[model samples]
Target: MKWEKLGLVCTADRFGVDVPTRVMVPTPVFVNEDTIRVFVTVCDKDNIGRPYYVDVDARDPRKVLRLSERPVMDVGTAPSFDEHGVVVAQVLKTRDGKLQMYYSGFERFRDVRYKIFTGLATSSNNGESFQRVKTTPILGGSDYESTFRCAPFVIEFEDRFSMWYVAGSSWETIRGKQVPRYSLKYLESPDGIEWPVEGRSCMELQHDEHGFGRPWIEIDEHGTYHLYYSIRVCSLAAYRLGYATSEDGLNWVRKDAEMGLEPTPGSFDSNGLSYSAIIEAHGSTYCFYNGNDFGREGFAVSKLIK
Candidate 1:
């Protein structure tokens, strides 16, 4: 697949936030035929993230329609699983007409530097506010993943939910900071909730890979699975978009060379591009993603170069 780069869409300052911060992971939620609401992770000066939403025209996604006055979901209390930050990974509408949000709860640790766990929230009102179902994490993988089980993307088919998330498999000490090593994993649930404690490995880690940022999937008309994610290398210290395809969701192959997206040498996204969110709307395909500085530089879009 090919993409046409579009520049930055939203900055935290537009939301009345301070400078030197970022707005990352702009995932689109279709509000209607003409409008789309992009949910984003807004980083604070402290480098903590909170989920926020902004409305944009579907015909021209860069135009701002509205912005959330406050965070749709905030960080948890002290000593809580998400005390440090909460990054919005996926939001899906259940069969019962409620929206379910799967997020990565951030926790800072002295031993490991940080740990991320999966958590859930539900929205009764369209796409406005959400309430946490519980404080405890919904995902508990192996000890390797004890430090991270995040970036969950779920697709419900036949009334059953299938999830693809990034799970840490190792930790590497890099220049005084603990960086995690992870790969893509999969799980199935009879309901949107109640997944097994562990997930089956989908995308294995490559020798040159440290971890993936987010895994996004979409079933094409031909029933082939399209997976888009970010590849992080410890040496690069930044992310670049990658892609894969599968006949069965369980088995996969990487096609990063075909992803056709990279940072522009002297652009806002030049530092890095990660946390990709793709949507098919208004007769076109567009991808929203985070740029350099982990979105401190803000979010941008890329149109399918069809």
Candidate 2:
């Protein structure tokens, strides 16, 4: 199957909105038959992050993305976890009539010292609001003393929840140094909170010219699993998308699509594309990825015509 550009759906400068100062990562999901829900992380100059939900009609071309009056979730003092900040959430409907949102959080005080963790929240109503689960830090720091854990992606398979998240050491140093290694790992949960996994790095960076991180997964119509991740060597600007496939969730094999998607000749995405989120709806597959060195978010659609 071939993918085609669907033009820019959401940009920083659209609808009289200010250009997002930090970064905009979108998680697009099909809420129902005629509506699509997009949860975006808006990072401002102050470095404070907020979650916004936008609902758009599936059939409208000149559609306006409507933001929810109130944020679905935010960083607050909960005593147990996530007092710093919350961002980049992946929402899914569980079997028991509840919405599960697996998100990444950072302790503001600890984040100043470079520490991060993952948290979970749930909503009975379809994303109108959410409540923090009693269990916190489903996945925490590793034995390596990794500094941060963020960017979680969740999927349900065989009555269980599977998650892939980014984990790495501190980019800053104790005195004056730089650490440049990041990786993606996998964990499993039955209740979307308690992940009991050992010290196992599901996917790590090989000592090669290209580095790998930011992994996202989607199961195709024929039950084939596709994984899209970021490959960066030096700077974040020199990043590209990579692809892999798996029959089962655990074992994966790399594919030939080394540069999964790149820039067009005369387009805004002429720089690069990464942070990919994919959803298959109505017999068509859509990939929503950020563009232009994380300047804006764009989308591309392709049909599984094979």
Candidate 3:
């Protein structure tokens, strides 16, 4: 596989607010025949991320159409699940034609620096705004996820919704900083909102990987599932993309070297990459991903060339 870089689209600096430090995790929502909205998590200097979006022309995804004025939704109020921050991952159009949003909430703890959990929101106004399914997370601190559960991507088949998410297994300290080591896990729900607390572990870390981030999947016409995720290289101390193919969503064959993406030298992504989002338009499949600073430098798009 091969990809052609399309350059950066929107940046956190465009917000023009109090130090719009980062813009990460480019998730898309289809609006109309000519419009496709790309939702991203914009963070402040303090590292508190809130979800924002920009609309682009359907024919050319790199062309900017409009930018969201305020956050689609704010962080949960104090003593709630998402007091610290909210990062948007994936958005899916349900069978009923309504938009369903999945995001990860940030929380702090004494033992660890922070924790993550998955939450659900729905947009009836066609991705304009959303109302939370509930204040508390539907899946977190479950049997498989010892510390955190986050960066969820979901797909639906009939009455069942399939989810691929990252869950923390353990923690390792590197140079006096405790970094979380996470593995990929799977879950299913009758409806997109309600999910089981316990998930089945499907993918673990490689010998050189310390953790994993958001998992995005694409189902081709042949029904083959292709999974893309970001792994933290312990030695390099930077994130890189990985790939795999699954006959069933449960079992996967790893092929990270074939992911067809990497940091472009002397470019914004030169340092690392994370949170892969793919949008197929025209005669090309485009991938939107975060660069260095976990999005502080902003996100860019890549066109599939091979």
Candidate 4:
């Protein structure tokens, strides 16, 4: 219910890439009992993103262990769904012992600002490298979700795979700039690869909220779902963390006031907080999140206190 902030862990400079200016989205997964590999995306000078990772000490995540030498995978060639770039969202180990990486693929368009879709890659030899399952997005555009269908967080069950992702068909102009309007949607796939054309509506935008970022679901011992996501506040031109609870993972009860996480004034996350992911290691619950301007100051961690 509350958290103790751990400040910034690692940034783009740690990778020693002159082209990358910012590190975005911290998707942390435990490689072992002592190592936490934080999968992230680094943006080039033109703002195109590529997925990389930073390994940190599980006991003290502020201590960086290693930085990935190259991107997990390269951007797609021209005319592909991920021709522009990719941002890693979540990585899960398959029943067959391979790593399944789900990410958001970025594509630029002249009509709108951009289009984002979900893509998948697989790493057979641990998390060192990956190969795209296909050139096109596994969850691409549909009639209902025409513009965006990205930021996917999936949980694989024995019988099915359940996903909570951001989806929308429209864009709105706010503050004289075009912005995509999206909300949470749910889908069920027999396998992690194939999915339906459209997803069942879960959470819709309310009040000044224009979009929802990544959906991170945590199931308690009793099987109650706690969904944590970021709301794109149109009026403020920034993001704020949102929380909700669900019994069946389809319907949700909004409880933003109880989220207990907020921006730290005069700090890296002073203006905006976005792209949050939760993981439990060594009996401690940790939340990894991004800061202002989509993590220009890199990602940080917070330990759950209550």
Candidate 5:
């Protein structure tokens, strides 16, 4: 779809980070009638990953009022896995009034390439404090899988919970060497615990000479589902976001410029922007996406002019 640029509402500046160096992926949420909360992955000067929460009053959306006193979550426990780092993703408020977080965990070890997994955490006090689910590592290695799972986006559909995550072969071939080039896959859970990947696991979008992966999807109130994903334009040595739509949440159709909301130039996002988290508010749509080579998170607003 072709999206008309409507200026940036928030930039990396809000976190005191310099472009091309620091990176931040923000997941926004409407906490209440008066508050908006953004959960971000904050890296220290030493590049250690930590979780930070920034809150703003819905009344004055421009002013950030509170930041967490300490990293709400971080790497803990060792040898088992996920001992190296952890990063936060979109937080969801369950039907039972509990807050659930879907996050990625990274572990390091010799003889093993790397391990990435999805974990679940819950909060009872409206997100102030959280406890990891007892049945942890909710999503991990398949019997024949390797490498890891990362960048999970989850949402409730109808009465079921669904997630789209980046998955790839544990092996890769690069310049006379082999490595893993991760791609995206889809899974669903009835209760957000035991997830089973769909038969059609990967996106079938035509590639742009490089490859494609990292999908973020959203279903609007009207039941229309939209997916925004990243694809590398090898000739340009850059990544770009592409759009597709599905009414049944399975088969999808790529929309062209003639359809509306095509890519635009200018702004911090002109270079590379993908992994878009989209939400609709006050009758308009806002997309929060990583910008400029996935080094920082920025937002762009569009009126869904289609």
Candidate 6:
């Protein structure tokens, strides 16, 4: 597949919102025929992130319609799972006509830099407001995934829900800095809420790659699966997009050379890009993603040309 790059769309500091730092992750969900709300996480001076959104025109996604005045849900109270920050990952509409958001809850620690786990929230008024189902994360520390379990993306089928998330148990020091080492994993749930204690490894780090960021899964009409994710390469010291395919969701074959999106020289994404989310509307397919410094300049879009 090929994509035509569209420039930066929304930054945290652009619209005069309270947050003044990064706009991480552009998770878009169709609000209507004309409106696609891209949910993101905006950070403050302390680097505490909360979920916000920017509404864009579906046909012309670069055209901004509105922005969220406040966070959909605030971070959890002190000593809670999400006390440090909350990054929105994926949002899906439930069978009961409510919206369910899967997010990575952040918490800082002295021994480790931080721990991230999956949290869930529900919205009934079309995402204007959200309330956490619980103060604790639904996908927290388990025997197998004791350290980190985050960046959850779920697709529901007729009988069950399939999830693709990043999980790891250890941190590694690379280039004299401590960083988390994780890879893409998969799980299934009868309901969108309860999941297994462990996930099956779908993709592991290869060669110079040390970690995997968010994983996005797309299913074609013929039932072929396409996976888009970010790989942290040791040589480059940055995140780059990788692609894969699967006959069954559990087993994947890497196809990195085929992921046509590349960083533009001297652009906001000159260093690298990550956290990609794909959506289709009005006969067009789009990939929304973050750029250098983890989207300090917000997110951008690319339209699929092939």
RMSD of each: 1.5, 3.9, 1.2, 0.9, 4.0, 1.2
lDDT of 3 by residue, 20-128 (tens): 8889889976799788899888888788888888999888887998998888899999877688889998989888888888999998889888888988998998888
RMSD of 4: 0.9
List the candidate 6 regions with Cα displacement exceeding 4 Å. 15-19
Q: Which candidate do you rate higher for TM-score, 2 or 3? A: 3
Q: Rank the candidates by TM-score, best first.
A: 4, 6, 3, 1, 2, 5
Which runs in model 1 stand beyond 4 Å of their true positions? 141-144
**What is candidate 1's lDDT per residue for 1-306, written digit by digit as tens?**
778887788877887766538888777877788988888888878888888899988998888899998889789988888999888998887767788889999898776668888999999886799899888788854554667788899998886889999887568866666689888888898976687877788778787678898888889999999988998866777888998899998798889988888889988887788988899887899999988877877788889976
* Model 5, span 1-306: residue lDDT tens: 445555454554455533323345666677786667767666555454556667755544445678766666666577644566567766888878888878877776676556777788888877776778843477777654455676777877568888877665455444444444555567777888778633246565355333454566777679887777666555455566677788876666765233343345765666776555555555555555556655454444444455
In order of appearance, the predictions have TM-scores of: 0.95, 0.81, 0.97, 0.98, 0.79, 0.97
Q: How does residue 257 of candidate 2 score in lDDT?
A: 67
Error of 5 at 138 (Å): 1.1
Which pairs in model 6 have colliding backbones? none
**Residue pairs in candidate 2 whose N, alpha carbon or C atoms collide under 3 angstroms:** none
Clashes of each: 0, 0, 0, 1, 9, 0
Candidate 3: regions farther than 4 A off? none
Error of 1 at 159 (Å): 4.0
lDDT (Cα, tens digit) per residue for candidate 6, span 1-306: 899998899877864556578898889998888999999999888898899989999998999999988899999999988999999999988777889999999999999999999999999998998998878888999989988999999998889999999999899888888899898888999988898999999888898988998888899988889998899998888999989999888889999989989899999999989988889989999999999988988899999999
> Cα lDDT for residue 126, model 2?
78
Clashes of 2: 0
Instruction: Say which candidate scores most in TM-score.
Output: 4
